[model samples]
Target: MSKSNRNLFFSLYWLFFLVGISTVLVGQVLPILARRFSISDSESGYFFIAHFAGSLSGIFLYNYQAQKSNFIRTILLGICASATGILLLNADSQVICTIGFFLNGICAGANIPAVNMLVAKLSSLRVSSSLQVLNFFWGVGAISSQPFFHALSSDGSVLLPTVLLAGAYLIAFVFIYSHRLEEKTEESSRVNRASFWTVWRNPIAWITALFNFAHVGLESGIGGWLTTYSERFAKEGLISATPVFFVFFVLGRAIAPAIIDFFDDNSFIFLSLLVLLVGLVVIVFSSSYVGLICGAGICGIGTSAIFPANMARFAKIFYPDASKHATPIFVMGSFGGAITTYSIGYLSDYFNSLKVGIFVLFANTLILIALQMLVLLGLQFPKKDKT
Candidate 1:
C-alpha cells in the first residue's frame, strides 16, 4: 500500500521464491548426487534428515526469540546462513555435500517462517490476497528451479546453477539489507506476539500443523521420486517431467486469489483434495511417459492451492498466534518431508520398485484429507478465537 510495503513484498517474495529451487531442484538432481557420492537411495535420506534438523531448529528458535528481534535482522541472518550452505554444496566430498544440505535447510528453516511472518503482518486490506501472492511467487520460484537445473545437467555442468543460486541470495541480501520499514508500534507488538505454550494448547493449531505435515511431505516426496520414476519406468529426464507439473502448480497458485471468495474454505478444501487424489491415482497407474507427465501436471495443479490457501486461513484463524503456530506446522512439516522422503526411498529399495515408493504419497494424501475433514467438522476445535 506504500513504499515500504513494496520493498517488503520484494524481499518476502525472493525469500520464499529462492528456496523454491531447493524444494524441487534437489529431488530432480538426487540421482546425480547419489552416483557422485556412491550413496544409495536410503542413504540419500541423510540430506533430507540434515535439512529437516536445520529447519526444525530454525522454527523453534525463531519462535523463542521472535519478539526480541526485528524481521529484517533475523532474515538477513538467515540469508547469510543459507548462502554459506549453498556455497558448500559445490564440494566433492560426501560428508561435505551432506553438511551443505543440512546448512542449506537451516537457512530455509529460519528464512521461510520469518518471511511468512513479515508478509502476514503487512497492513493490507486482506491477508488472504497477500498470502496468495506470496505463494504465487513461491510457485514461480519452484518452476525456475526444475527447468534451470535440467538445462545445466544436460550440458553436464552444475557450475552455473550454483553461481546463479549464490547470486540470487546475494541480490536478496543487498536489497533486504538496504530496505527499512516503519517500526512496529508497542501496542501492535504486544498483540502480535504469542508465547509457544498458548499456541500449542490450541487443537486447531495442532490439526493445522499436521495438515502442513502431510501437504509438504507429499510435495517433497513426489519431487524426490518423480525423476527416478521418469528415468526407470519411462523414457525421459527430470526436467521434462517437473515443468509440466510445476507449470500447472503455478497456474493454480496464480488463480487462488480469484477463487478464495468464490468458495468457502471447507468447499475449497474438498475440491482441491479431490483433484489432488485424482492426480495421484493417475500417477500410480500410468506406464507411459505421456501419462506420467500428464499425471504430474494434474498433481501440481492439485497441490498448488493447498499450501497457500491453508496458510492464508491460518493467518485468519491464528493471527497474533500465527507466527507462533507456524513453528509446529513447519516442524511437523519437516518431519513429513523427512520421513516421507526417507520412507519412499527405503520402501522403494525394499520392494525394488519405484512404483511402491509413490504409494507413500497416495497414502499421505488420503491422510491429509482425513485431517481436513476433522477441521470441517469442528471436532475438538473452538468456534472462535480471541486475537
Candidate 2:
C-alpha cells in the first residue's frame, strides 16, 4: 500500500475505535441515567429510540450528500458531530442527554458506512481479512469501555469520562482532518454505483436488509441490557459481567481472519450464528453467575465475525454496485437496533423481568438464523442482477 493509503487506514481504524466506544457508552451507563432521571424501563427505552432514529436520519443524509461529494468530508464532519454528542451527555437534563444520544447515533450512522466503504476500496483484494482486522480494533475500543466506564464512574457519575472522551474525539478530529489523503478520481464520487432503487429490487438486498435488522438488533439488545440483566441475578457488580462479553467479542474478531481462511464466508457465518444461538440460550436459562458469564463470552464470540463477514460478502456479491447499496443496509441495521433495543426495555417493563425481555432477542436470533440460510442458498444460485 502507498503511504497515503496507510495513513488513511490508520485514521479509519482510529475512527472505528472511537465509534466503538461511543456506541457502547450509552448502554454501559443506561442504568445510572435511568436512576438519575427517575425513568421506568419503558421510558428509558426512548434513549435507544432517540439514538437510532438519529442514526437513520444520518444514513439518509449521508447517502444523499455523498453522491455529490467524497467520503473524507463526511467522515470529518461526523467525527465532529460525535464529539458534540458526547459533550451533550454531561448535561443535567434527561432531555438534553437523550438528544445527545440521538446525535451520537447520527454520527455512527454516517461514519460506519463511510469508513467501511473507504476501507473496502483501499483493500479491494483482501476485503474480508482486512475488514476483520479493522473491526478487531473496534472490539478493542468496545472492550476497553467496560473497565474505562467502571473505573471512571466509581463515584456513580459518568460525566467526567464522557468529558474526557469528548476531548479525545476533538483531538482525533483535528489530527485526521489535517492529514492529507486524496481519493482516487474514480472512487471520489458515487456516480458509477447502482442507484438505491436499483439495488432495492434484488432479493439479495431484502435478505441482506432483514438479516441486518435482526442481527443488529439482537447484538445491540444484548450488549445494551446485559449489564442490567446480570445485575439482577448474578453476584457481580454492574460492569463486571459485561467485560467478559466484550472480551470474547474482541477475541473472536481478532482471530476471524485466520478462521475465514479455513472456512468460506457463508460457512463461517453459519457456525458463528449457531454459537451465538447457544450463547443466547445459555443466558436465557442460566441462574448461576458462572453460566451468565460463560454465556456472555459465548455471545461475544458468536457475534464477532457476523457483521464484517456479511459486509465483505455484500461487497463481493454486488461488486461494482456494492458501494451504493451499503447505505440502505446500514439504515436498516440502525432501525433494527433502535426498535429491538427499545423493545427489550419495553418487554422487560411489561414482564417485570429482564430475562423475559432477553427472550425477545433469543427469538430474533432464530429469525436471523433462517435469514442466513436464505442468504447461503441465494449464493448457490447466483443470478444476474438486473440493476
Candidate 3:
C-alpha cells in the first residue's frame, strides 16, 4: 500500500476500534440500566432494537445524502450522533437514555459500511487482510472496554463509562474527519442507481444473506446473552459474569485473523460451525458452571472467524464489481445480528429458560452449516457442457 493508503487504512482501523469499544460498552451497560429501570429481561432487549432502528434509519439516510456528497461527511456525522448518544446515556432521564442509544446505533450502523467501503477502496487487492486487520482492532477495542468499564465503576451509576465512550467517539470523529478522502465521482456513481433490493436479488446474494443471517443470529444471540448464561451457570451476579464473557469473546475475535490465513475460508467456516455445534451440546448437557464456561469458550472459538471469513469469501465470490453487492450483504448481516440478538431475548422470555434460548442458537448454526454446504456443493458441480 502507498503511504496515503496505509495511513487511511490505519485511521479506519482505529475508528473500528472505537466503534467496537462503544458497542461493548453499550452491551455491558444495558443490563445495568435494565436493573435500574426495573424492566424484564425481554424488555431489556428492546434497547438493542432501539439501537438497531437508529442504525436502519441511518443506512437509508446515508444512502440518500451520500450519493450527492462524500461518505467521509456521513461518517463524521455518525460519529457526532454516536458521541451524543453515549453522553445522553449518562443522563438521569430514562427517555433521554433511550433516545441517545437509538442515535448511537444509527450512527454506528452508518459509520461501519462507510468505513468498510473506504477500506475496500484503499486496499482493493487485499480486502480480506484489510478487513481482518480492522476486525482485530475491533477485538482489541472490546477487550479494552472490559477493563475500562471495570475501572469506571462507582456507586451504582454507569455514567463514568458512558462519558468515556463518548470521548472515544469524539476522538474517532476527529481522526476520520481529518483524514477524509477526496471523493471520486467515478466511484460515487458506480452504483448510485442500484437499489439495495437490486443487490439482494442475486442468487448468491440471497444465499450469502441467509448464511449471514444464521451466522450473525447465532453469534450475536450468544454474545448478547452469554453473561446471563454465565450468571445462571456460575450463580454469580450480572457484573461478575460479564468480565468472563468479555474475555472469552475478545480472545476468540483476536485470534481469528491469524487463523484465517491458514485455512480456506469455506473450510474455516465449516469447521467453526461444527465446533459451535459441539460447544452448544456441551452447554446444554453440562452439569456445572465450569462445564458451561468451557462450553462458552468453545462456542466463541467456533464463531470467531465466521464474520471475517464469510465477509472475505463474499468479497471474492462477488468480486470484480463487489462494492455494490458487498455493501448490501453487510447491511443485511447487521440487520440479522440485530434481529437474532433481540429474538433470543424474546425467546428466553417465552421459554423461561436462557439455556433453551441458547440451544436455539445451535439450531441456527445448523442452518448456517447447511447453507454453506449447498454453496460448496454448487461450486463442486461441473459447469454445464456446451455442445
Candidate 4:
C-alpha cells in the first residue's frame, strides 16, 4: 500500500477499534446499571436489543444511501449518529440510555459496513487478511473498554465513560472527514447499484448467515449476560463482577484473528463451538468464582474468532462482488445476537435460572456446529489447505 493508502487503512482500522470499545462499554456497566435502575434481568437485556435494533436499521439505511453518496459522507453521517447517541446516554436516564443505545447501534450498524467496504476497496487481493486486521483493532477496542470503564469508579462515574465514548466518536468523525479520499464517481455509483438480493439468494449466503447467526447469537448472548452470571458468585457485588466478564470477553476477541489466520474457518468454527459447549457447562455447574472466571475465559476464547473467519469464508465463496450482499448477511447475523440476547433474558426470567438460560446458548452452539457439518458434507468436505 502507498503511504496515503496505509494511513487510510490504519485510520479506518482505529475507527472500528473505537466503535468496538464503545459498544462493549454497556456490557461492562450492565450489572451496575441493573442495580441502579432496579430493573429485572430481562429488562437489562432490552438495552442490548435496543442497540441491535438500531444497528439493523442502520444496515439497510446505509445500504440504501450508499447508492447515492460517497463513502466519506456515509461514514460522517454514521459518526454523527453515534456521537448524538453517546450524548443522550450522558443524561443517565434509563429511557434516554435505551434510546441512546438504539441510536448508537444504528450509527454502529452503518459505520461498520461503510468502514469494511472502505477497507475492502483499499486493500489488495488479500481482502480477508485486511478485514482480519480491522477486527484485530476491534478486539483491542473490546479489551480496552474494560479498564476504561473500571477507571471511572466513583459516585456518578458512569457519566465519565459515556463522555469519553462520545469523545472517541467525535474524534473518529473528524478523522474520517478530514482524510477524505477521492474516487471515480462512475465506479462508486456502479458498485452501489449491484444486485444485493441476488447475492442474498445464493445458498452459500444462507449457510453463511445461519452460521453467522449462531456464532453471533452465542457470542453476544453470553457476553451480555456474563456480568450477571459473575454477580451470582461474587462477594464484591455486581460492579466488580462486571470487569471479570470484560476481561474474558475482550481477551477472546483480541486473540481470535491471529489464530484464525492459522486455522481453516470451518475447523476454527467447529472447534470454537465445542469449546463453548464445555465452557457453558463449566459455567453452569461450577460453584466458585474461579470456575466461573475460567469458564467465561474459555467461552470468550472459543467464540472470539468465529465472526471474522465466517466473514472471510463468506467473502471468499461469494467474491468479486460479495461485499454488498454479504455485508447485510453479516449485519443480520449481529441482529441474531440481539434475538438470542433477548431470548436468554426471557428464558432466565421465566425459569428463574440464568444457568438454564445458558443451556440455550449451548444448544445454539451445537446447532451451529451441525449446520457447518452439513455445509461441509455438501462441499464433499474439501481438504484443508495450509495458508
**TM-score winner:** 2
Top-lDDT structure, candidate number: 2
lDDT of 1 by residue, 268-327 (tens): 766899899999988889877778888899998888888866766677676666654477
Instruction: Rank candidates, lDDT, best first.
Output: 2, 1, 4, 3
| lDDT by residue for model 4 (309-335), tens | 677666666555655555567576667
Per-model TM-score, in order, reads 0.91, 0.93, 0.87, 0.88
Better of 1 and 2 by TM-score: 2
Model 3 poorest 10 in a row by lDDT: 378-387
Q: Rate the local accuracy (lDDT) of all candidates.
A: 0.75, 0.80, 0.69, 0.71
State the weakest 10-residue window (summed lDDT) of model 4.
378-387
Q: Which residues of candidate 2, in runs, are more than 4 Å off?
A: 179-181, 184-195, 235-239, 378-387
Of the pair 1 and 3, which is ahead by lDDT?
1
lDDT for 376 in candidate 2 is 76
Write model 3 residue lDDT over 1-387, tens digit each, in one string. 577666666677878888777665556676567667877768877777777778777776566545554567777888888888888877777788889878887776777666765665565676666666777676667657656765786755777887777887777777666666555544456465564445566677777777876776675566567755676666653344345544665676677665666767777778878887888887789987777767777776677667776766666655544544454554566687678777777888998877666666867877898988987777542221111
User: What lDDT does candidate 4 reach at residue 48?
Assistant: 90
